[model samples]
Target: MIKNLVHHKDNIVTISETMNCLDAIEILEQHSLRNAPVVDATNTLYRGNIYRYHIYKYKFHHPDADLAQVKVTQFLKNTTRVVHENDSFYQLIFAIRDLPFIAVLDKENVFTGVIQHDVMINYLAQAWVADKSGYVLAIQTRGEKGELNKLARLVNRKADIQSAVTFEKTTYDTSTYLMVTLPEYLDVSSVRALVNDLTRRKYDVNVVTL
Candidate 1:
């Protein structure tokens, strides 16, 4: 799977307790961000998450009021939570819904880094592409060691098949399924004939396209 835990930069959205509602809005707009974390001036303690929706609601009702005059601490949700660097990807997905970020902290609660959603998405996509298409093959063999290697060597010798791979399925016992990419065109009957030959030799072979 994905190995880059610090795939996203650690500069999480943060604001000072002295910041007002207007200041929070400005930070969100400048970064194109929807939310930010409020922190103390010393940066030692997390305050809470400031959401765009709450700011808009406040502005609608108090049209003439000065947002800068209102302290962010007044609106703080007061439920600060964080995630560790060693947390799993599955845990991160759930944490993002409520936290939008997982503040990396030391044992003394010192901020070390941050993880964002965009970076996580990029890392996961790269991992999926690598796992799915790394191997290609075509063969007719029983589910046994050395059988796949023998088919690969045969295809490589003939120069007709460029690459080959085998997939195995086990219900009560294991069976081999083969897939191969070939350069020359072969008709359906010719393919069936090859499969029949493999069956005569006690191989359960299924041809799959790549």
Candidate 2:
């Protein structure tokens, strides 16, 4: 399913290993990129990433260094962060947390494509059906069993449940936030009724219009 997040090979911007820092900086600036993946001489093997700031910082620290002599490989990084096509979404999430994107390679280490954070945001937006009109009920619970079923039962009686996503557990109180969405056909009264029901059941609930 994570393949849906991948930007295919032809869509990736790459800098050749032989390319100088001066040229790489220009290309990165033109694309409004902070960094770009680097490839081997044949442009098949993925070397790593080259950052625009790193090139400028290097020049500032070493003013005498010739820009033409500075190859992109000199500042290559995140070589080990690349993922295989079959890698999982959870793995990609951790691998790309600190990176703008993660380069994806084939079994032979051939550069295939990349998965960027922006694409991940889009995927999450699609999952939330953000473009469609709906109301989100942000509910907090203590992870008690039967709570979700009760909430679902109550919501379904009044409105169609568009989607439900559980956010990460809160460290402070060890509670979970469940975002339940209602279809556009429902009104504020429907949401208010559900909120009152959940509140009476000791479930912390709030409604947000989307």
Candidate 3:
């Protein structure tokens, strides 16, 4: 699923290593960005990133220093983490969690655009669970054989599923949860019946959406 979420290089804004700190700062301000990837003169190679705070710090400590003469690369940080374009959505989610933005690389390992933190949040907000026209059902079942099929059959009897995501919910490995999203057109009575049926079948069911 994540293989399709990558942004291409042409869409990313980057600075060149040859650009001075003043020009780099101007570019950042123009885009209303806190940091941007730095590249070579050809703008194809990934150097590192430069931060706005670092630029100001450099200038503040050296008030008489020529800002235009100082190269942007001097303040570059090597801690930038990049993700591959073909990486799964799950991988991208983990990559961007603690990062302001993550660099994306094409198959050739060329620097592409960045996946900002906000972009991921927006993506999640639009996920099936967040769909207003649907109900997100957090259905808990055991890891035993045919549990998923049983759950599916019960849900299928009442509503059309929009999306389904399953994950282990318990630490001791006693139960698993499936985040199943049912289409919005399904009436409350049908959902209530579905939950009743699931509970009758011994499934721990919870309506996660209002």
Candidate 4:
């Protein structure tokens, strides 16, 4: 699963531990990169992660210090952040949250590549099927057993489902929020009929328009 999301080793931009901050910064700037994986001399083992901002921050403090003498290791940020290839998608999301990227490794701890920040955004868009023209419904209902199945039963009678997701309104609250997308060709009459059915069953539903 994660193998599909990873940018393989050959596609990665990496920095060696022996490289000075000056050379590392040059590589980062050339690619307009903010983060890169740091590796050992052989480029096999993962050392840690470095960010362009940390180097700039260091320079601001040690104005007279020569960056060429400074190793990239001095600025490593996500040193302990890494994911094994078999890790769950849930683990990947939590580990990758808000970072430029996170390292991916194999069973033997060999560096594979990374899961980039932009890739996660695209995954979310795909989950919502954002590129397709469709009817979307924003629904709110009490958190209870079989809520989704009941809604599905109603919607199936009217149109085929394109995508669906459920989330709690708040951690401490009992309310549930759901988003469901339907086929684009389904007529408005069918859509309205589905909504009416849901409402008659006491579900709070809204037709979401983009």
Cα lDDT tens digits, model 2, 29-82, are: 999999989988887888889998899999999999888877888899998888
Candidate 3 vs candidate 4: which has greater TM-score?
Answer: 4
**How do the residues 82-161 of candidate 4 rate in per-residue lDDT, one tens digit apiece?**
99899988899899987888999999999889999889789877877777746888778676788788878778899887
Q: Which stretches of candidate 3 lie over 4 Å from their true place?
A: 1-6, 57-66, 78-80, 121-132, 170-175
Worst 10 residues of 4 by lDDT: 167-176
The 10-residue segment of model 1 with minimum total lDDT is 128-137
Q: Candidate 1 or 2, higher TM-score?
A: 2
Comparing 2 and 3 on lDDT, the stronger one: 2
lDDT of 3 by residue, 5-41 (tens): 5556677778888999999999999999889888888
Better of 1 and 4 by TM-score: 4
All candidates: TM-score: 0.54, 0.90, 0.81, 0.92
- Please report the TM-score between candidate 1 and the true structure: 0.54
Query: Cα RMSD for candidate 4?
Result: 1.9
Per-residue lDDT for 153 in model 2?
Answer: 87
lDDT of 4 at 190: 87
For model 2, what is the C-alpha lDDT against the true structure? Answer: 0.84
For all candidates in order, the CA lDDT equals 0.63, 0.84, 0.80, 0.86
What shift in Å separates residue 191 of candidate 3 from its native position after superposition?
Answer: 0.8
Which one wins on lDDT?
4
